[model samples]
Structures are given as C-alpha cells and as structure tokens.
Target: MSSPQRSMIAKVDSALTRCLCVLIVWLISASIWLLGLLSLSDLTMRIFAYGEGWSDVSWAELSFMVIFAVLLWRHTYYCRYFAIGIWKGMGRLLAFQGTLACMGLVIAVFTVDVEQHLGASVGLLETGADPALELGELGFILLALYLAAPTSVAKRLSHSPVSNVESAHTTAEKEFTV
Candidate 1:
C-alpha cells in the first residue's frame, strides 16, 4: 500500500478502536446502573411492604443506595475520557465497582431467597429474580472486571504507538535529568 493509503487506513483503524472502546464502556456502565436501579426499586418495595414501614435502618439503606447511584453517575460521566485513550483512573473505578457487585451478588445468591427478597419486582434478567439471574449478573460483572483490570489496560496501552512514544519521551527526560 502507498504511504498515504496506509496512513489513512491507520487513522480509520484508530477511530474504529476508539468507538468500540467507548461503546463497551458505555454498555458496562449502563448495565451496572440498571442493576443498581433494580436493587433500589426492590429495596423500596420491601421498605413499603405491609407491616414493614420505613425505619431508621431502612432510611440508612435508602441513603446508601442514593450515594451509590451518585457515584455511578460520576463514573459514567468520567468515561468520556476513554474515547480519547485516557485512562484517568476509570479502569480502577470500574474494577472496584465490579468487585463490589460480584461480592454482593454472590452473598445475595447464597443467603437471600431471590424471589422472596425481590417480591415480584423486576430484576436484572427481567424474567424474575432467581439465583441463576444473579449468577448471570455476576458473570457480566466478572467480565467487566477482567476488561478493566490493570494488566489488561496496560496490555492494551502497550499496543498503542502513541502510548509507547509518550513513555519513551518521559523515559528520555528522566534519564537526561538524572
């Protein structure tokens, strides 16, 4: 291929890669947000159930859910940087959220009766709340975690010539200053 053709191809490839990365990040974020919303809805239903009027603990739980929603919203906003090939701690944020979700879902699967706890409320699966649905959600969380892992991010960055160039420039500066 000619030089201009190769350069054009490279630019197109880079754009496509960026778009794919952004799409994946958006999908992961949206999934997690949906899960959180469902949980919040279920909790609200339980709190308002007959003979289960809101209490101090119920208020605390609701507050925590609100905080979680806010944090997730912020993280979603920060995801815009990923389109420009900036990590900006978004990977760490994703890993942390994914790990927490995995642990919470595992515990819920083992200890809580999914149908009983959810109480006719919709769940992540949309069919009904069940251990199998929780497990499916767990699988997704694990996949997100794997994708956001530091090693995985590093590997992806290493393949980018811009990252390599930046690293080399920084190394050269460090060597000259020392």
Candidate 2:
C-alpha cells in the first residue's frame, strides 16, 4: 500500500520473473542437449547392431555425432552464464555453434529415421507417433534457434547502481572537457 512497500513488491516481482525466465531457458536448452545425447546413443547402437564391429561402422558419421553431442552438452552448461551476462563473447560463439548444432540435428532428424531408432530402442516398434514427435522436436529446434539468437538475452543483470553513477560521471567529464 505504501510507496516503500510497493517498491519492495516490484523488486520481488522482477526478481521472480527473471528467475523464471532463466529456468525456462535452462529447461529448453537442456532438453535440446538431451536430444543430442539420445541421437548419439542411437547412432552408437545402430553401429553395433548392424555392423560387423566398430571398425565396420561409418567413422565419419560417428565422429560427427560425437562432436554434436559434446557441443550441445557444453552449450546447455554455458547458456546459464550467457543468460546472466558472463563471458558474452564466448557465449555468442557457443550460441552460434548451438544454432549450427540445432541445424545439424534437423538434418539428422529428417534423414536418419530417428523415430524408428527411438521406437526400436524403447521396444515400441510402431507407435505411429512419428508426426507428433517430429513436431515436438521441430518446436524445440525453433526454441533453440531463438535461444541462440543474438538479440535475445542481451541485457546484463547488474545489481550495482554504481554503473549508472559512473556513466553520468563520464558524461559530465566529456561535456566539461569539450
């Protein structure tokens, strides 16, 4: 009701909103990474299931999957820092890589019959849920792309008010010097 109480409520509300946003971003990013991991496992299983041995498998594809999985995992871990405005340059680079990884995932999803692999692995031969699964994955991929975007999550959360004071001080210095 009072001014101070209103101000406190506003601060608490903003903090809660920020935390919720971060948690949502984390869930999305982590889910994407888990998809990558699942894909990698499927590939590994297929290699062992059909091939005479590991040597008979396609090394190139296997290696690519491994790299993709690692990138996704790392991106999932680092995105939290990125969201909080730490190591922005590294975050941008990782985000770009994450975008590329998502694209790679798109290709893999379409080309590799991921549903079949997933179904087989889980002992469900024909659930007929391919369309739904694909749509969900596509949605997640789009979310990943959104997370990778440069404009999103650009604002740094600074608790200190000194930055405002410092900027004003610099502006005053410039005006007096000129």
* Per-model TM against the reference: 0.33, 0.35
Off by over 4 Å in 1: 1-6, 51-99, 106-178
27-116, model 2: which lDDT tens digit per residue? 877665555545434545644655577665455445644654665556556566456444554455445445555676577666557657
Q: Report how far residue 4 has shifted in candidate 1, in Å.
A: 9.3
lDDT (10s digit) by residue, model 1, range 30-79: 67655544544454454354555555334434654565566555555445
* Residue pairs whose backbone atoms clash in candidate 2: none
On TM-score, the candidate that comes out on top is 2
Candidate 2 lDDT score at position 148: 49
Q: What is residue 132's positional error in candidate 2, in angstroms?
A: 20
lDDT (CA) per prediction? 0.54, 0.56
